[model samples]
Target: MEIKIIVDAMGGDFAPKEIVLGAIKALKKDRNLKIILVGDEKLINPLLEQESSDLNVEVVHTDQFITMEESPKAAIKEKSKASINLAMQLLAENQGDALVSAGSTGATILSAAKFLPVIPGIERSALATVLPTARLHPGNHGISLLIDVGATLHCTAKQLVHFAYMGSYYVSHVLEIPRPRVALLNNGTEETKGGEVLVKTYRYLKEAPNLNFIGNIEGTDILKGTADVIVTEGFVGNIVLKTLEGASEILKHAGRYAYRKRLTWKVGLALLSSGVRQLKKRTDYSEYGGAPILGFKKLVIKAHGRSNAKAIANAIGVARQSVEQNIAEHIGDSIIEFNKQHRLDFIDI
Candidate 1:
């Protein structure tokens, strides 16, 4: 199947340059993948000459671009021609199978939630991202899908439960994990540790039939691979995500400084260079591509704001995989079944 993906060329900090380079790389990789670049043709077209510029890739002209500082709702309402808005509109119109953007996170989420209908029984879409872990899979390093990384800042216990179901289904279907273990992120492992909502969610997950609930896990357990899927609200989850990013940066700077300074430390680093490179690759954010906004009618991936060509290509790959895996269809069906079994009335948000 030819998986068509809409790329917001003007959305990110590097913008059309990195995005175009990434799109070209992705197109070269998969012949069955088609790319629709939404941005200013005047700026994006010339870059096509730098690569293959094959018919598989097309550009939709739009000079409007939304910045990181812009209000998401206002941008969506006013900037009708903005790359993110137009790309999403194209997706809503069935012009593409999935959409990937390194643009404003808030704008992407708000626009997707507004234009694209949420899956039945889903109140809000959750950002589900895969983070590296210590354990290794057969062909790849270990990764767990962390739900609600930054989609909805505040979530009700019911919403967190919904995220848990969505994350479980995602890992099971996409990651091919059988009955993947699910864990709630809390301050402590004890059932009495978290606040009212966390406590309530713990009970909900524990009592839910068929869920491989393994009790609560602390922040330290994330990279230790304590659970297959970690479920939490966006506010806390985003903080955890950013903390990992900051720590990775600090380690990288320290490693550079150590290598440039003492000869003894440099010699030690040289001995472990191979292992160090492997570890860095395992922890790199680009390996997992971008985070997907789960519970949506269509697949929408949110890449990092400072994504490069490699990252953008990987994000496109993630979108392609999600489409091929039928992630949206599975989530929709699974949510409906879950609501029916739980006797919870579905209400449109």
Candidate 2:
């Protein structure tokens, strides 16, 4: 079956040009892919012309666009025809199978929740991203799934439990991991660490039969490939994510300085170029594509804010895999069954 995706042409910092170019690249790569470009026609049409005139693409012109600094609520309300809002509406109405955006994270999440129905037994949706782990696993790219990377700022114990199951299922099906191990992010490796919410969530997860609960893991455990799915609330998860990003940047700059400052370092860099390139690829956020807002009715991918053409294309790849694997539906049904099997009142918001 053909997988249709809606791309917010004006959502990213490199709007229309990079976004459109990426969409065209995706369409060329996947014959089953079709795209609906949402943005101003004047800007988008010319870009489309640069690509092959004969591409499976549709354009939806909109006058309004939400800027990066604009308030999500105000932008959505005032700019009803905004690219993000309209793209989401199209997905809800079944105009497409998935929606991808490199726009404002706050605005995209707010609009998606308002526009799409929640998966059964899920009151809130969480963002899940594939992060490159420090250790490489067989037949994998040294990557693991990180959930709640900043969707819901605050969450209850039950919500973290929900994120665990959803993240596990996502990794297993989408990433093709079998029985992925799950862990809770805490300050300590002991079972009794973390705040009240995490402590309570640990108990719930431990008792959950379906999940492959592997006990508690600390912040340092994340990049070490300690767990398949690291479950935490958005606040902590976001901090960990940004810290890694910053560290990667620092490493890149430090390597450049070291190479220029010493002759031996220059020779070492030339010899290690292959390894360094591989390491860079693994750490590059763009290579992982966008984070999926799990537990939603339709597939929604939140691409990075400064996403370029390649990043946008990779986000489309993630969305395509998700649709093919039927991840959204599986998570909805699995959560319902999990609640029933455990005899717990989890569906309550």
Which number leads on TM-score? Answer: 2
lDDT of 1 by residue, 104-178 (tens): 999999889878988887887899888888873332238888998998889877788889988988788767778
Alpha-carbon shift of residue 246 in model 2 (angstroms)? 1.4
Q: Rate the local accuracy (lDDT) of all candidates.
A: 0.87, 0.87
For model 2, the stretches where C-alpha displacement exceeds 4 angstroms are 136-141, 342-349
lDDT for each residue of candidate 2 in 1-349, tens digit (9 for 90 to 100): 9899899998878887889888988899998889899999999998888877779999998978999999998888888889999999999999999999999998999899889998888867998888888764443437888889899878988788889989998888877788898999888978789877888888888988679898998887788887889998898889888898888789889999999999999999999999988988887878888898988889898998888899999999989899998888888777777677655544432
TM-score of each: 0.92, 0.94
Candidate 1 positional error at 309, Å? 2.0
